[model samples]
Target: MTNLLLALIYLAFISLGLPDSLLGSAWPEIYPGFGVPVSYAGIISMIISLGTITSSLLSDRIISRLGTGKVTAISGLLTALAILGFALAPNFWVLCACAIPYGLGAGSVDVALNNYVALHFKSTHMNWLHCSWGIGATIGPYVMGIALSGGGSWQSGYWYVSCIQLSITAILFLSLPLWRRQEPEDYGANTEESPGSDASSAHPRPLKLSQVVWIKGVKEVMTCFFCYSVMEQTTGVWGGTYLKLFKGMDAAAAAAFAGMLFLGVTLGRAASGFLSIRYSDQQLIRLGMILTAGGVLLLLMPGPAIVTVCGLMTIGLGCSPMYPAMIHATPQIFGREHSRAIIGVQMASFNVGMFVMPPLFGLIAQHLSVGFLPVYLALSLGIFALMQRRLASLYV
Candidate 1:
């Protein structure tokens, strides 16, 4: 039963990731079809980020009321519907509207599941479950590529993924019994509390954001979170555009290559799960920081197209362990009572980064060239390193 429940959660995480890469992969075709400026992708991305922000901040209350089972199921259904809306839309405005529910669903499911799994599952399960997310993320671009190939419609891509989403939603709805069967455990243990637990009220009642912001080390950690998110989301959202416009790939090829980062991520997290047995969370994070720098340097160099593609994969590989390790470390950094709330705030900071930077880069791509992406990523990575340094100092 435990293994079955964990498998279900992994599936849920996969659902969380399926739609994430679609727009970025399809955007070159989408923008041309919709007759919008290339920068308009930012508008849609920003709207999605805004919705995620709202839902992420409100996740605790919603999860408290709905339980993890219902919240996951309902959010899955919402995302499925939103993806279908994207498939059927006639105008860019409808795409923009569809972005709303997708964002809201994605954010709440992310927060709820991450927190739930962190407490109930093994430490390594958290890492591997995220790998499951990478799997879905990797598949998205391939699906879009298939849809765009042979003169097929991008709508078909979203349509297929929406069908997958509906399937996952049904599984989640069926697993409500599993979620209900687990009891809440004492989340305060230094180790994962127990296998049989749910995330309901996992943290003590959340503190106000004003208060959470003032906790020792919170500022630095939040800065790290924000910078990390900016790099990751910006890359996911704009990586294909960079490939298409600057690297001379056609829409189909660029869309397919966009999955390279996610593929690297999927592999990296799988490796990290095993590495965690021998290394501390901070140790894994530090290694990631170094790798990310090397990856960014690779991007900045004048190179063959393959070199640039390799650079994207390297960046994705470097990023894999950082997020889950950071979340796993929260209870130790702050008290367990405060960890859940602080993690929520961290995610909010992450959402804020997602909200602002992608569109900001859209303006950059609009006025300047997407050629500036490497430099932009380099700067973001440098800032992330600095904050992680500060966070480490305060951590011990």
Candidate 2:
């Protein structure tokens, strides 16, 4: 039963990832069809991010009321319906309208599942589960590429992916019985605390948003999460466009390279899952950060198309471990009682970056040059590294 539940969780992560990069990958084809500038993709992204932030803010209360099982199942259905709307929408405004429910579904599932896993599973499972997400992320762009190259519309791609999401939602609904038996708080109350960590204050009531933010390192942690989101999403959303605009690649090639980025993430997380058995999460995160910095520098260098692709892969590799590691450590840092609320706030912070930064980058690229994106990503990485280090000090 436990193993089956874990498999379902992995599937949920994959479903979570399927639509994430679809907009970005499809945007190059989509904007032209809509008679909009490429920068218009940012508007859709911002709307989605806003919706995600709102849902994340309400996740704790909603999950408490509905339970994680119902929340995941319903969110999956909502996301599927939203994706279908995206597929069938007649105009850009309809696309924007669809983004609302898409964001809401995504944010709630992400928070609920991450909290559930952190409370129930080992660190390695967190890495592997995210790796499953990476697999879906990787597949999305390739699916887009095939649809576009075959003279099919981006709507076809969205339609196909929406069907997959709907299938997953049905499985999630059927799996609800498993969640009732698998609720981990009853089995692993100790999962939230690290050895030698403070436990006396551990059993406090669930935190309000204000109280979670008032915790010592919550602000800094939020900053770190925000920067990470910016780096990851900027690349996912804009990297292909950047390739086409500057590197003289065609749409298909650019999309393939974008898929490579997520493939790198999938591969990197697979390695990190094994590495977690032997190393601490902090050490793994620091290693990822250093590799990420190196990747950014490679992107900034004057190079061939292959070099830029390699750099994107390196960035994905670097990003692979940090997300899961941070999530896994949340309960340890804030206490299990407070983790769901804290993770909800953390998801909100993540969506804030996702909402705000891509459009800001788009405006700059519109006015300035897409070439500057690497510089922007580098700056985000540097700040994120510093924030992660500072947050680490709180534990030490």
Candidate 3:
């Protein structure tokens, strides 16, 4: 039963990850078809994230009323439908309309699964569970690249991904009983009395940022995550277009390069759990920020295709461990229950960064040069690293 439940959870994550990978890779090809400017693509990307932000705010309450299994099922269906919408969308407006449900479904699954894993699974499982997202993300671009290389349309790639999601949705429905039948002890009072009890108590009560320990550390973490998210999404959302416009890469070649970025992220995240076990979270985070900054610097260099790919990969590696480390470290300082609330607020910050920076970068690219965008990424990451000490102390 445990194994089945874990598998279902992994499927849920895969569903969440596939769209980002596919859309990011295929954006250059699809964007022009909709007859919109490149800058509008960034705004369209935010629509999905905006929906996610709204869903994250309501996830706790929704989960409590509907139960995790039901919510997962509903999200799965919504995602499956949204993928189909993306495939069939006729215009920019239709694509933007599809983003609404896509974001809601993705956000709900993300928060619900994270909360469920933290509450019920061990630390090792938490690490593995997140790695599942990397797996799906990696697959998303790879699949899209193959389809486009075969002379398939962008819509065809989405159709293929939608089928993968539907398959996972079937497995989740089959395994619903295992997830729903939680042991009484799992939710009993004894678990609440544990050292991290205060964290849980923070949840049912209204949110107060003051209740969080390590206010300085929280700020640092937030800044780091915010900067990283903006940089990551900016690249993911715009990299394909840049490749097409500046590098003169064809759709298939561009998608392949984009896949390489996600592949780098996958390899990085897959190893994060093992690395965190060996190093302190603070050390790991510091290293990640440094690597991310270094990667951005590499991107700024005038170089060959190998150098460019290497730079993007380095960026992916730098980003891979930060999210999990931030999440896992939170409970060590804030307690388990409060972790969700803290993360929710943190995610809000992340969304705000994602919402603001991509379009801004797009505008900059339009007015100036694509090469200049990496400088902004470097600056954001450098600031994040400089402030890591303050974030670390928040836990202390």
Looking at candidate 1, the ten consecutive residues that score lowest on lDDT are: 189-198
Candidate 3, residue 22: the lDDT equals 75
The alpha-carbon root-mean-square deviation between model 3 and the true structure, to one decimal in Å, is: 4.1
* Candidate 1, residue 2: lDDT: 66
* Pick by TM-score: 1 or 2, better one: 2
Candidate 2: segments with Cα more than 4 A from true spot: 27-39, 143-153, 184-206, 240-259, 303-305, 366-371
Best by TM-score: 2
Tens-place lDDT digits, model 3, residues 34-78 = 877766776667788898888776665666567678778888888
Residue 93 error, candidate 3, Å = 3.4
Taking the tens digit of each residue's C-alpha lDDT, what string does model 2 give over 1-396? 767878899999999989988997798778888898887886887788888898898887888777788899999999999999999999899999999999899888899999888777777989999999878877887888888899999999999999999999999999998888655342234433322233454434445688789987888889988999988888877888888887778998997797666777889999999999888778888988988888888777776877888888999899999888888888777766777788898899988888788879988899999989899998999898888878886552
* Candidate with better TM-score, 2 vs 3: 2
Worst 10 residues of 2 by lDDT: 186-195
Question: Candidate 1: lDDT over CA atoms?
Answer: 0.81
The 10-residue segment of model 3 with minimum total lDDT is 186-195
Q: Report lDDT per candidate.
A: 0.81, 0.84, 0.71
Error of 3 at 287 (Å): 2.2
Candidate 1 accuracy as TM-score: 0.85
Clash count for candidate 3 is: 4
